[model samples]
Target: MTIDDHKSHLVTLGKFLKQFQVTGSKKDEEIPGNDRFFEDFDQKIDNAIHYNGWFTRENIIFALQQWSEALTPQNLKWWLGDYNLNQSGGKTVGIVMAGNIPLVGFHDFISVLVSNHKVLVKQSSHDKQLLPVIAAYLMNLDSRYENRIEFTKGKLEDFDAVIATGSDNTARYFEYYFKGKPSIIRKNRNSVAIITGNETKEELAKLGEDIFRYYGLGCRNVSKLYIPKDYNFDNFFQAIYEWNPIINREKYANNYDYNKAVYLMSEFKLLDNGFLMLKEDKNFGSPIATLFYEIYSDETELEKNLEEHSEKIQCVVKLHPGKKEVKFGHTQKPQLWDYADNIDTIDFLSIL
Candidate 1:
C-alpha cells in the first residue's frame, strides 16, 4: 500500500477510537467497519483494566482520546509531510514495549508502519490487551495491515532493526543482544517540574495533573520537584487538593500507606496530606503516591546542573523560562512529533 493508503486507514481507525470516551461510548455512523470492532472495543477496554491495576478506566479513556486526536488526517499529513516514503524496501522492525502506562509504545508501532515497515511487537504483559485490539481494527480497515503487523509472546526473531524500552538494567541486555543490528534501546528516565514560587494557583493546579496522572506510573509523569529555597508548600497543597479523590483507589492508597510507614520508621522528615507525601530527595524517580523535592537557590545554576545531567531527564516542565520546555500539565499529552528520548523514530525507520 502507498503512504496515502496507510494514512487513510489510520484516520479511519482514529474515528473509531473517538467513539469511546470517559463520559460514554457512541457509535459513529460515518466510520465504516465499526460494526465488527465496536462491540470488541468495549470488551478490550474492560480486559485492559482488569489485567493491569494502573490501567484505570479514566486513564484508558484518556489514552484513547489522545490517540484519536493525534490520528487525524491533517495531523498525520503534517507530521509526515517532510518524510520521503517513495523508496519502498521496507524492513521488519521489532518493538519491545513498556507497560508503565496504557498504549505507551504505540508511537513506535505506528512510526514503523507509517514509514512503510512491518512491525513485530512484543508487548509488555501488563499491557497486552489494548494494542492488539487496535491493530485488529486497523487490519479490518485495510487487509494489507494484516501482513504488516505482528505480535510475539516468545523470542523476537527475523527483524532488521529493533526498538526496546526498559529500565537501565534491561537496557544492558538489549544493548548486548542487539549489538549487531541498528537499534534504539531506551533506559529509565524521569520528568521534573521547576517551581518559581510565583506560579498562579491555576498553573499549580494543572501541575498537579502532571504529577498525579496515570497514578504517577508513566515516564512523563513529574516525579520530582525543583522549588525555590524556603518556599512554603501551602499554596501548592491547596492547589492540588482537587485530586484528593485519587487516594480512594485501593492500589494507590496501599502505596501511600506503605511508603508513609517506611518513611516514618526511618525518621525521615516528610510533608503528608493524607494522600500524597513530599520528601526532600535529590533523586528523580520517586515512588508512587510520593513526590521527591529539592530546593534550588539559583535558577542559572539549576539550569546548568540539569543540562549536565540531561540524559537522566525525560522532560523538563517549566513556566515561560524562555527555553524549550514542556508547558505545565502537558507532560503526558505529547504530540505526534514529540519523539520519546529525543530520538526521532520516523527518521530512524526512514533511513532503514
Candidate 2:
C-alpha cells in the first residue's frame, strides 16, 4: 500500500462507520441520523454505549477526530516530515492488539496503514466487532485494501517491525519472546489528572468519563490523582458524583468491597472514592479498577517524577490551562502531529 492507499482506506472506513451508526442499531447510534448500520449491534450496542464506568464519547470523539483527520497522505506525510521521514516502500508488520479499550489497537492500525505496510492484526476477543466494522468500511471505500488488512489470531515472528500492547507482565513475555526484533513493546499505563486550582465542574465531569469509562480497564484510564496540599476533595467528588447514576454499581461495589477488605482490615493505605481505589508504588502502563491512585504534593515534583514512570503513564488529565503534558485523561486521544514515546512513530516507520 501507498500513502494514497492509506487515505483511500480510512475515508472508506469512516463512511462505513457512519453507515453502521445509522442503520446498525439504536444502541449503536452514530452521529444523529447520518447512518443506520448501528441497528446491527442490537442490544449489545446499547450496553456498549450506556455501559457505565468505561469510555465516554467525548474521549472517543477526541480520538476518532484525530484518526479521521489523519487519513490523508498530506497529514500522514506532514506528521512523518516532522521527524524527517516519509513513506517509501511497503512492509509487513505484526500488530498485537490490546482490547483494554474499544479501539486501543487502532493506533497501530494507523501506523501500519500510513507507512505503506501490510498489517497482520491479531484481534482481541473483547473487541471482536470493531475491527471488522472498520475493515468493512475501508473495503467498501476501496477494494484494494480488502485483502491488505486482515484479522489474525496467531503469533508472528516474521514481520519487519512489531508493536505490542499488553499488561506489564505480558510485556515481559513479549520482550523476551520477541527479542532481536525491531519492536515497540508497550507496557501498561494509567492516566492521572493534576488538579491545579482552576478546574470547573464541567472539566471535572469529563475527567470522570476518562476515569470510569471502560470499567477503568483501558490503559488510558486515569488511575491516579495529584493535588495541591490540603486541596478540597469535595469539589472533585461532586464533579464525579454527576456520573454516579451511571456508575456500574456492581463493579463499583465490588471494587469498594475489595479495597475495604484490604485497607480497613488489612491496614492497607488505599485512597478510595467509595467507588474506586488508590494505591501507590508501581510501574506499569495501567492499574486495576479496584485501585487507581497515588497522592502527590507539588505537581512540579510529580511532573519530574513522571519521567521515572514514563513507561507506564499513558495519558494524564488536567484542566490546568496551558499545560501540554502527557498527563491523565489524555491517553486515548492523540494528535497526529504529536510524537508518542518521544519518538515519531510514523516518521520512524516511513524510513523502514
Candidate 3:
C-alpha cells in the first residue's frame, strides 16, 4: 500500500478507537467496517481486563483515547511530514514489546508499517490480546496490511532490523543478540516531576494524574519528585486527594500494605496518606505504591544533576513558562511525534 493508504487506514482505526472512552463506548456508524469489527473490539477490551489485572478497563480506554487523538489526519501528517518515507520499504522490523501498559509497543509497530516496512512483533505475555484485533481491523480496511503485520510465538527471526524495550538487564542481552543488526535497544527509564513551590492547587492536582494513572505502571508516570528544600507537602497531598480511590484496587492496596509494612519494619522515615507513601529517596524508579523524592536547593543545579543522569530519566515534568518540559498530567498523552527515549523511529526506519 502507498503511504496515503496507510495513513487513511490508520485514521479509520483512530475513529474506531475514539468510540471507546473512559466515560462510555459510543459506536459511530459512520466509520467504515464498524458493523463487522465494533462489537468484537468491545468484547476484546473486557477480555484484556480479564487477562491482565493491571489492565483496568479505564486505563485501557484511556490508552485507546490517547491513540485516537494521536492518529488524526493532522497529527499523522505532522509526525511523518519531515521524513522522506518514500525510501522506507522492503524491510521486516522485529519488535520485542514491553507489557507494562496497554499498547505500549504500538508506536514502534505503526512506525515500521507507516514507513512501508513489514513488522514482526513478539508481544509480552501480559498484553497479547488487543493488537491482533487492531491488525485485523487494519487488514479489513485494506488487504495489503495482511502482508505487513506478523506476530511471532517462538522468536523474532528473519528480520533485518529490530527495536526492543526491556529492563536495563535485558538491554545487554538485546545488544549482544542483535549486535549484527541495526537496532534500538531501550532500557529502563523513569519520569520525574520538579515541584516548584509556586504551582497552584489545580496544577498539582493535574500532577496527581501523572502519578496515579495506570497504577504507576508506565515509564511515563512520574515516580520521583524534585522539590525545594523545606517544601511543605500539605497542599500537594490535598491536591492529589481526588485520586484516593486508586487505593481501592486490591492489587494496589496489597502493594501499599506490603511496602508500608516493609518501610515501617525498616524504620525508614516516610510520609503516608493512607494510599500512597512518599519516601526521601535519591532514586528515580520507585515501587508500585510509593513515590521517591529529593530536595533541590537550586533549579540550575537540579537541571545539571538531571542532565548528568539523563539516561536514567524518560521525561521531566515541570511547570516552566517558556521551557518545553512536559506539563502536569500530560505525560501519558504524548504526541505522535514524541518519540520514546528521544530516538526518532521514523528516522531509524527510513534509513534502514
Candidate 4:
C-alpha cells in the first residue's frame, strides 16, 4: 500500500478511538483506545505481576496530547526517510514483549508497524488482555491491518527482526537466544528526579504519582530525589500526606514493612508517615515505592555525578529552578509529546 493509503487508516484509527470510546475524551474517542484506555485509566492499575498497573484519566490525557504533538505529518516525513511499502522491503519483524510496565514495548511495536513490517507478537500473559482489546478496535479501522499484526504464544526464534524487553538478567538469555536476528534487547531501568527547593504543591503531587503509582514498579518512576543538604522535607512530606488515601493497599504492606524494617535497623532515625520511604543512598533508583536520597552540600557536584549516569536518567522532573512541571512520574505516565529514552521516538520510528 502507498503512504497515501496508510495515512487515512491512521486517521481512521484515531477516529475509531472516539467511536469506540477507547483511550479518552480529551481527544475524543475518535483517536484510538480513547475510552477503553480511559476505562483502564480509572480502573485499578495495580497488577503486581504486571507493572503496567497505575494510570489515571489525567495521565492518559497527558500522554495522548504528547503523542499527537510528536507525530505530525511534516515530522513523520522528516523522520521516516525511505522505508516504504512500495519498495517491497525486508521481512520486517516480531516482538516478544515485556509485562514489566504498561505497553513498555509499544515503542518497538509501533516502530515495526510503521515500517510496514509484519509484527508477530508474543504478548506477556499480563498484557494479553490489553493489546488485544486495542487490536480489536484497530481491526475495525482496517481489516487489512488486522491480519498484519498478531498476538501469539511462542519463542522469538521465528522472526526476522526481534526486540525483547526483560530484566537485566534476562538480557543474557535474549542475547544468546536472538543472537542471529536483527534485534534490540532492553533490560531493567529506573528514572529519577532532582527536587529543587522551589517546586509547587501541584508538582509535588504529580511527582508523588511518578514515584508511588504502580508502587514504584516501573523504569520511569522516580526512585530518587536530588536535594541540597539544607533541604527540608516538610513540603514534600506534606504533599504526599495529602494524598494518603492512595496507600490503602494489601500489596503496599510489603514495601511499607520492608522500608520500615530498614528504617528501624537504622534506629528509626528516618521517620516515615507510612506512605513513601526515605533513606540515604548514592543510587537514584530504589525498589518499590521507596525513595533514596543523597543530600548533597553542593548541587553542582550532585549534577556532575548524575551526568555520569545520564544513560540511566529518564526525566529531569523540572526545568531550571522556579516553576515548571515541578516533578515527574513513571514512564507509564508520559505526556504525548514526551520523547522516550530522551530521543524523539516518533522520529526514530520514521527512520526504522
Q: Which candidate leads the pack in TM-score?
A: 3
* lDDT against true structure, model 3: 0.92
Instruction: For each candidate in the order shown, give its overall lDDT on alpha carbons.
Output: 0.91, 0.61, 0.92, 0.60
List candidate 4 segments past 4 Å from native: 4-7, 15-89, 266-269, 319-339, 342-352
What digit string (tens of lDDT, one per residue) describes model 3 on residues 1-352? 7778888999989999999977778989899888998899989999999989999999999999999999999998898888898877899999999999999999999999999999999999889999999999999999988899999998889999999999999999999999999999999999999998999888899999999999999999999999998999999999999999999999999999999999999999999998999999998999999999999999999989988999898889987623447988899999988888989989999999
**How well does candidate 3 score on lDDT at residue 266?**
99
Residue 72, candidate 2: C-alpha displacement in angstroms = 7.7
- List the lowest-lDDT window of 10 residues for candidate 3: 318-327
Give the per-residue lDDT of model 4 (tens digit) for 227-319: 876888888898777657556655666667776887688784564667767777776667665678877677678667767877677655553
The stretch of ten residues in a row with the least summed lDDT in candidate 2 is: 19-28
The lDDT leader among the candidates is: 3
Which digits, one per residue and each the tens of the lDDT, describe model 1 over residues 268-333?
A: 999998899999999999999999999999999999998888888888999764445798988888
Error of 3 at 325 (Å): 1.6
Instruction: Give the Cα-based TM-score of candidate 2 against the true structure.
Output: 0.78
lDDT of 2 by residue, 95-149 (tens): 8887656667787787777666777888766655556656655655567677667
Residue range with the least summed lDDT across 10 consecutive positions in model 4: 41-50
